[model samples]
Target: MTTLLTPDELEAALRTIGAERYHNLHPFHKALHGGRLTRGQIQAWALNRYYYQASIPAKDATLLARLPTPELRREWRRRLIDHDGTEPGTGGVARWLKLTEGLGLDTAYVQSLDGLLPGTRFAVDAYVHFVRDKSVLEAIASSLTELFSPTIISERVSGMLRNYSFITEETLAYFAPRLTQAPQDSAFALAYVKEHARTVEQQQAVINALKFKCGVLWSMLDELDYAYVAPGHIPPGSFRPQDDR
Candidate 1:
């Protein structure tokens, strides 16, 4: 028989899942933060990651659109604003471009996503589907990855700065705001899960939701590592770094 845990216990289990499975611990990230990747590898990482960043506001909006309450919609709209920005050539996507541009990739190619990995597309699209198809609680729980993002962001920023002469503070501007925003967003989502997940079943669902999301992120990196680093198989019609050969 399966064991049911208290809300506090479930929260601890979720945190443990993150500690164990989150992408921060992935070898690719270790290579990235440890300055082991080449410029081409870094560029490949950024280009592939753009898809994830671009999809965030849309996923958030999809969840917001399903929200029945004006208060919830109003709260979620800020995430859209944060990613979409108030004007042209701003916000997270644009800032991500800055990183790509700093790395010498053409903005058009990166934005056009001409070189995206098949696995990257599949994993991110699954996230969108999860938000659309799942309950509001599960949708919100999927974003609990944000709870662990700040740590990765901090390591990436500091390590990249020290390691890559081509990288600049401006290139990393996207992560700066997220440092504060992620915690604020995750705290609310966590508290909501704890409060609303009154039943053992609901609580278990929330835990599963988080684990599923962690898998989503992990799968993305695994794709990148396989396609770009290990097997080095650049799939047909995907972006190929100049030095890939």
Candidate 2:
């Protein structure tokens, strides 16, 4: 039988997963932050990523439905507001649209998701389904990826500002609030997992959940890299770069 990990040990193990498998290590991110991608390629990324951004609230709502406590429900409800806002034309989704618009993507076309890659769609939808169908422990554990977000957001904001003239601070505003929000969310999630995952199996499941979430993120970038970068094989009907568009 697997031994149960101490809470500190489990936390360390989770951080180790982030160190090794997070999408920050993906070549697509390296290309993006390094400014190696052309404007059209960046546009393709923004357009496709908008689908993931738009789906976040729905994912949280599904998880929210599964929470057992009014306190937990109230805590999780903040995520809905963070993404969807109390009103339309605000919140993270709206900020993401600003990014897409700044990238010269038509907002209608972006929202239509008409140009989104099949892989991006599949990966993101899988996340929503995972949260809906999995154990609440696993679902919350999956969000532990947020533990690493602040660092990546800082890198991305600074790199994009320095490297891409087309990228203004306003275009990158979506990440600014996330710098604070992600840490708060992740801390709660990490504490919840460490507190609740009392058995060996549950601890292992939590670790696997983080791995699965990382795979979801990494695979999105893999598709982007395969389709958008070298030997480019963008699938039919997806957004084509400007040269091809």
Q: Local distance difference test, per candidate?
A: 0.87, 0.93
Query: What does the lDDT read for residue 171 in candidate 2?
Result: 95
Instruction: Summarize candidate 1's per-residue lDDT along 1-245 as a digit string, tens digits.
Output: 15777778878988998998899989888988898888888889999999999999889989999998888888788888889999998788788888889888999888887899989899999999999999999998888998899999999999999998778898888899999988988998888887787777787788889989999889988888887885588789988889631
TM for candidate 2 is 0.98
lDDT of 2 by residue, 1-245 (tens): 28989999999999999999999999999999998888888898888889899999999999999999998999899999999987878899999999999888889999999899999999999999999999999999999999999998999999989998899999998999999999999999999999999999999999999999999999999998999887789999999877432
Candidate 1 TM-score to native: 0.96
Q: Which RMSD does model 1 reach against the true structure?
A: 1.6
- Clashing residue pairs in candidate 2 (N, C-alpha, C atoms within 3 angstroms): none
Clashes of each: 1, 0
lDDT of 2 at 64: 97
Highest TM-score scorer = 2
